[model samples]
Target: MGALELLPPDTAAVLREAAARTAGVTGLVVNIAVGYGGRREIADAVKQLLRAEADKGKSIEEIIESLDVDQIADHLYTKGQPDPDLVIRTSGEQRIGGFLLWQSIHSEFYFCEAYWPDFRRVDFLRALRAYSERNRRYGT
Candidate 1:
C-alpha cells in the first residue's frame, strides 16, 4: 500500500490517487519500487531528518550528538515496515544491485536463473523452500 521511489511528478500523482482508492483495504500491504535506489533513499532520508530536527529547534550540534539509527530509520521511506525476510532475485542476477541496502542487512536472498517474465509459481516455491531450509543467523 506504499511505494519507495524518487518518483516523477506524474508518477507521484498516480501513486497518490491509487493510495486514496485503497485507503482502508488492509489485509496485505505491498510496496513497489519504481525509480528507486538505496543510496538515493538514504540521502533523501538524511535530508528529511535534518529538516525535521531543524523544525524542532534543534541545532546542528544537538542533532549530531543525539543522532542514531532509529532517527534515520524514522525518515526512511519504508518507515513503518519490517525489513524483508526473503528477496528472490530474478533474471539470473547474483548481486543485490543495491536494492533496499539499508533495510536488507539481515535478509535471505535467492537467485533464480529465470527472468521475471519467465518466472513461474514453481520457481517461487523453490525459492521459498530454499529460504525455509536456511538457518537464519540474523548476523548472530
Candidate 2:
C-alpha cells in the first residue's frame, strides 16, 4: 500500500518497508489504510460502483434499485478482503478518527498512548493481549 493514497510529506518509504517486510506472509491480512480517510474511502467506493454500473449501461433508477452493501463493497479499495478484526490507534489518540468507517462495523479497537514512530514491540504485544481478551459480539 505504499504511496497508495498519499499526496505529499507522508512517508512512502515507511509504507514500502512495511510492504517489503510483510509481503506474502501466508497469514492474516493486514490493511495499512494509509493516506486514507473513512469518508473518502466510502466516496471512492461509491464512485467506482457508479462508474461500473454506468459502463454496464444500467440506468440510474435501475442502479439505485439494485444498490446494496455487497455491491458497494465489491468496488471498495479493500474489495474481497475481510473487514478488520482489530484496529490499533497510536499517538495517544482514543478514537479511530474515521479509519474504516463502512468496513469496521464490528471491529475491536486498541488505543495506545505511544505515537506511531514510538510504538514498540512491547506495545504491540500489549495491544494483541488486549484484543485477545475482548468479548466480541459481532453485532449480536
Candidate 3:
C-alpha cells in the first residue's frame, strides 16, 4: 500500500526526474490528491475566484455569473483527464461521495459486493461487459 504522501517537498520534481531516468518521460502531470475532499475542493475553487475578483476590485455577482462547470473543471486537479466512462465502487456502496462530480454527469456506475482487496480481474471484466451491453443513450 504505497501512499502518495510519503514524498517530500518538490516531490513532483523528484518523481519527474525518476520517471525520466527510468522511463524516459520528462513531462507528466501527477495529481497526488490524497486526503482530497471534493466539497473542500469546490470551496477552495470558490475562494480562489473570490480572491481573484477582490484583487481586481470586482463584485461577487459579476464573478458568480461568469462561473461555470468549465471554470470549475479548469480549477480542478483532474482538469485534463477525461471523465471516466465508468466508475466502479465495490462493496455495494451506493453513493458518489463527490468523486469527479462535474465530470461524471453521464458516466455509468457499477457496484459489487466484493471488497477492494478482494476484487478480481473477472469482476472488472464483468463490469466492462455490462457497460458494453447497456444502451448508453446518455439520458436521451
Candidate 4:
C-alpha cells in the first residue's frame, strides 16, 4: 500500500478527467509528467498534431506553418500552466534529463544534495527562498 500502488488508478482518472474537462480551454495547462519520457512526449505531440490537422482537412504545409514551438507547447498536456518559476532538482543531479524541456526554457534551476526520499519542507523552502533572491534575466 505504498505511493506507487495507490497512484495509477487515481492518476489515470484525474488525467482523463482533466483532458476531458479542458477540451475547449486550448490555453495554459499543467501536466505533472511524472515517469514521463521526453522523446516519447515529442513523438506523441507530433502524432497528435498530424491527427488534428487531418481531422481539420488542413494541408501538411499549413499545419507545418502553425506548428511552431509555441503551438506545439499549446498542444501539450500542460498547455496553460505557467512555465515553472524555478525547477529544483534534489540529490545533486547535474543533468536535466529532458524534464519539461520546452516549458523550462527560462526557468531558474536549483540542484540540491538531499535525496528525494529524504527531502524536507525546509529544503523546498530553501529552494524557493533561493529562487526569490535571484535576479532572473529571461535571456535579456
Each candidate's lDDT (Cα)? 0.86, 0.85, 0.70, 0.75
Quote the lDDT for 109 in model 3. 88
lDDT of 4 at 139: 67
Error of 2 at 66 (Å): 0.6
| Residue 108 in candidate 1, Cα distance off native in Å | 0.5
Residue 25 in model 3: lDDT: 40
Worst 10 residues of 2 by lDDT: 1-10
Model 1, 38-112: lDDT tens digits are: 999999999999999999999999999999999998998889888888887888989988788899899999999
Error of 3 at 85 (Å): 1.2
Query: Tens-digit lDDT track for model 2 on 104-133?
Result: 899998999998878899999999999999
Off by over 4 Å in 3: 1-3, 6-34, 53-57
Residue 82 Cα positional deviation in candidate 1, in Å, after optimal superposition = 0.6
Model 3 weakest 10-residue run by lDDT: 25-34
- lDDT, model 4: 0.75
Better of 1 and 2 by TM-score: 2
- The better candidate by TM-score, 3 or 4, is 4
lDDT of 4 by residue, 16-84 (tens): 787688878865444444667666666777788788887999999888877777767766655667888
lDDT, candidate 3, equals 0.70
Over 4 Å off, model 4:
1-32
Question: How many collisions per candidate?
Answer: 1, 0, 0, 7
TM-score, per-candidate, Cα-based: 0.80, 0.87, 0.68, 0.74
